[model samples]
Target: MFHYNATNLPLQGAPGSLGRPAKGAAKKPPPRRRRVTLYGLTFSLPLLAWQLLFFLAPLAFLVALSFWTVRNFQMRPDFDLVNWATVYSNPVFWQTYLRTLVLAVGAAALTSLLAFPCAYAIAFKLSEGARRWATFLMVIPFFTSYLVRVYSWQIFLSDHGIINALLGRVGLGPVPMLNNTFGTMVGYLTLAFPLVVLLQLFSLVFVDRRLIEAAHNMGARRLRTILEVVVPSARVGLVIAALFCFILTFGDFVSPLYLGGGNPPTLSIMITDTTKAGQQWPRAAVIALTMIATLLAAAFGAVGYAYKGRAR
Candidate 1:
């Protein structure tokens, strides 16, 4: 009959304490996060140094050389605006610049358009084994020297070449394909087509299949679905492929010189012409710098468009 209730019993610990920690007790600190460390810098420094040495140093030297004077076919370290003024004043330079720009833009557009269907088939229509084989075949083109490939094309594209011989057998006769814009485009396609197809296939394969299926479920036609969903999903890859084509075509000297017969010389040809004409290396530097600037502007613009509205 003398049992005590636990609730009514007095606590034997600190005053006003109800089995809780003291207010003055030390609290645990939050874990520290390292944004950058010596470990990361150790790996990144080598790459940074490489770029500094090979890219930045050379670029800086070229810029300085462009402003220097050329006396007696010798480049002298003297600040002069003669090279810039002369290059900018030349009508031929401007004309060649315009032509190079047009050809590069044309190559980018043409290559992207041509590569799309082949990439789509590889990505969606082929089985895994077939896809692998197709990709492997595409890669085979890269194994051969690009110069050798261009040379070999002469065998097929030149007048009375295999193509024209076949055409002759069909009573169609020969067609002039070489030493013209057509031949230049063919060479550009040879350089860029397979690469574009591969890029597009890689992007297309990673697209969400469910989104495509949902488009079909909503009564959208296959073409419409691809236009609305697939193309948008793969826009980055497509744009980048086109950009690469532009860069390659813009700076190319071989195709335009050999295939197109250098009828309308590009910027690369202009640089060579400048250098060979009294060894005007400073003026050549100016042309090279202009090309670099154009490529940078195009690349920045394309990348901005491709990644618009994308998350960081």
Candidate 2:
């Protein structure tokens, strides 16, 4: 019998050997992950640069401007709290802020409520071709200038406008629609409704048809299915739509001015008024900062709510 000692044998170039590489052999390739990360960073650089240049720089300047002093209609770069103090102390500023907040919230709520049904119909009821056409039509509003559209609305919403003229025939209304909260809401809807509907439609269309079918098979009615299943599933889009509506309405100048007649000025109107009154750019900057803060809070809160549960 032959006794073989495997451990005593030479291991170099042997099958499954743990020996080091030969002198002339290539070193192991570096990790692809590091290369991939580098590529991603390279692609993202332009966007980062753009944001830094346009958005962050302007935002920082606006903050600095708020702390600046205005003397004889000229902005003087100074570290002063007078602008903040004056804005905070004024009852009118607070009132305008509150009014703007209320109106923005109201517009968001109203626009979402109004847009949902339209979106649902487009998503679930329409054929593919019809859906495409409807979407195209929704986009058509954007082709015309928003200012032009607002002006056009004036012709229809005014006291002696076509709507009121028709209403007068029925002895119904010369209703005070224009130059009020109603007009402001109308303008808000005009701006946000189509966009909201499009957002909701996209969300709804991507929903699992199987889930909807399962609900139907389980004896869930339309309204119940919508409230329980559809709404929950599409909550992110809906909330985002409402958030956009809030942001747009909050910052809108045209609607409140042209339609609402600037009777009780909003924050945007206040900014203009501040600048116009005495070129109080610092005060305006304070208002702008306040608005930016409010918007950021609302956006963060809504996004948090939208993505409340499930996986990370």
Best by lDDT: 2
Candidate 2 residue pairs in clash (backbone atoms < 3 Å): none
Clashes of 2: 0
- In order of appearance, the predictions have TM-scores of 0.84, 0.85
lDDT (Cα, 0-100) at 270 in candidate 2: 92
Which regions of candidate 2 are displaced past 4 Å? 1-47
lDDT of each: 0.87, 0.87
Best of the candidates, TM-score: 2
lDDT of 2: 0.87
**C-alpha displacement of 230 in model 1, angstroms?**
0.7
lDDT of 1 by residue, 1-312 (tens): 122234655553322354454457534322223335455578878999999999999999999999999777677998999999999999989999999999999999999999999999999999999999999999888566788888889999989799999999989868999999999999888888888888888899998999999999999999999999999998898889899999989998888888888877899988888778876889999999999999999999999999999984
Q: What lDDT is obtained when candidate 1 is compared to the true structure?
A: 0.87
Model 1 residue 269 distance off true place after TM-score fit, in angstroms: 1.5
Give me the displacement of residue 278 in model 2, in angstroms: 3.8
